[model samples]
Target: MLPVAAQQNLPVATAQTQNIKRIPLQRFEVPGTAYETVIGIAEIGPNVSIGRHTHPGPESGYVIEGGFELLVEGEPPRMLKAGESYKISPHTIHDAKTGADGAKVIATYVVEKGQPLAAAVK
Candidate 1:
């Protein structure tokens, strides 16, 4: 489980209406390695746009409710609805916006030990 401070430090969409609720589920450290896998669920508000950001490692998520518009650098923007899933490569700058009905997703990340999960991008 991530500490409260760490969870609070996670970035959220810029809009006041936008917010991210991260429910840390599990974490596993790789033996003899500096990598750790973290799992969590994220709830995004309706019509919210999570600001552009990059992760310290790869991330994957499955939409559990509603839909989202996802844009990753160098790739065409795409829409993912409930039951759909997406993967983001390490350090890939990306952004997401919830659809009219908002969205919820279960996300898992394989990240470096002692590194912040995400960093905002300009």
Candidate 2:
């Protein structure tokens, strides 16, 4: 895992309103180790997808550019436009897709130490 300082030293979104904003990134702690955090860029790319996956803990994300829709178990597809955000609890099965024009978002993942980025479901 990357060090927190190293991650912080890198350049990232810093705006606080409108087009850009700097928000608190969430981190998940393991039973007996340091926490893990998912740092996201404002506008990643168009049609970007992370595939169906699982989280060891909880995850949260906010749209920053364009828009996208999400489908989680027991829920309907939710359209999240720029400035919108959502959170997923640990072990939730889900997948994400970028908007037609592409979308950018800031996502914070709380995962246990040594957890896979995501566990693909069959």
Candidate 3:
């Protein structure tokens, strides 16, 4: 994930905000283990939200840019900004919401091989 400070360097945007984009960066199998590692960047457009979802395994993430409110099921929502990192347990449902400017995050998942990275929550 890129940081919001980096976004400030870009040209100003129009009134309308952009949508969330998930760009996979890399993936590799963990030798001697049943897990694989997947790394990707999530570009959350301003005023947008990624609906509630759950990972096949644990998720380790870093906020590189902008800011967002993380709504983890059964927990109070919290605001996270650049330079911060977070961990989500396997199968925990959660959602991410952004302010007017949006946020960028880089995340890594250590999941069972051949399983989908994430599943949508009802």
Which candidate leads in lDDT?
1
Please give the CA lDDT of all the candidate structures.
0.80, 0.60, 0.75
Ranking by lDDT: 1, 3, 2
Candidate 1 residue lDDT tens string, 32-107: 9999888888777788888788888998999999999999999999999999999999999998988779888988
lDDT of 3 by residue, 1-122 (tens): 31232222222223322475567687889999999887878788888767677777898899999999988998999999999988889989887888987888998888898776777666
Best by TM-score: 1
Each prediction's total of clashing residue pairs, residues at least 3 apart in sequence or on different chains, is 0, 4, 6
Better of 1 and 2 by lDDT: 1
Work out candidate 3's RMSD over C-alphas. 7.6
Worst 10 residues of 3 by lDDT: 2-11
lDDT of 1 at 41: 80
| lDDT for position 121 in model 2 | 56
Clashing pairs in 1: none
CA deviation > 4 Å runs, candidate 2: 1-34, 42-49
Q: Ten residues in a row with the worst lDDT in model 2?
A: 9-18
